[model samples]
Target: MLGIAAAVLFFIAFLINAADITTNDVFSSVNVMLIGLGLLALHVAGIGHGRRTGRR
Candidate 1:
């Protein structure tokens, strides 16, 4: 569940970045990239938690 949430959040960030790039908003693009990276990290942490618990 947490992994799925993180994936969705990252996807939203991707969309935001794409929109910003299309509009030539460099600052917003960078911000979106940072947000996406944070979400990716969360996703990885969730995966680690599952691994530690021996759950698929």
Candidate 2:
């Protein structure tokens, strides 16, 4: 669930940044990168939990 939430957030960030890329805002790009990093962290955490619980 957390991973899924993170994925959604990352997608939203991408969409927002892509829409405003024409303006070339550095802050927006940074925010998107941060969102992507957060998503990665959530995915890693989910994988770790699955491995520890030995469940599908």
Candidate 3:
């Protein structure tokens, strides 16, 4: 799930960068890309992987 989120964020950042969008400092393409990287790192660290509950 986090990988998916990172991919989406990366795509958004790519779109923003490719389109040359003008936005606030917080939501800039670089920031989005950084956030995506952070998520990817967390995913790699196995932080958010929930255990599955087997059905009875």
TM-score of each: 0.41, 0.46, 0.86
As for model 2, its CA RMSD to the true structure in angstroms is 5.0
Q: Which tens-of-lDDT digit does each residue in 12-33 have in candidate 1? A: 6677666654544544645655
Per-residue CA lDDT of model 3 for 1-56, tens digit only, reads 88999999999999999999998999999999999999999999987777755697
How much is 2 displaced in model 3, in angstroms?
0.6
Give me the candidate number with maximum lDDT.
Answer: 3
- Per-residue CA lDDT of model 2 for 1-56, tens digit only, reads 55766677677677777786553565575676677677678777664344365568
- lDDT of predicted model 2: 0.65
Which pairs of residues clash in candidate 3, taking residues 3 or more apart in a chain or in different chains?
A: none
Off by over 4 Å in 3: 52-56
* Clashes, model 1: 0
How much does candidate 1 score in TM-score? Answer: 0.41
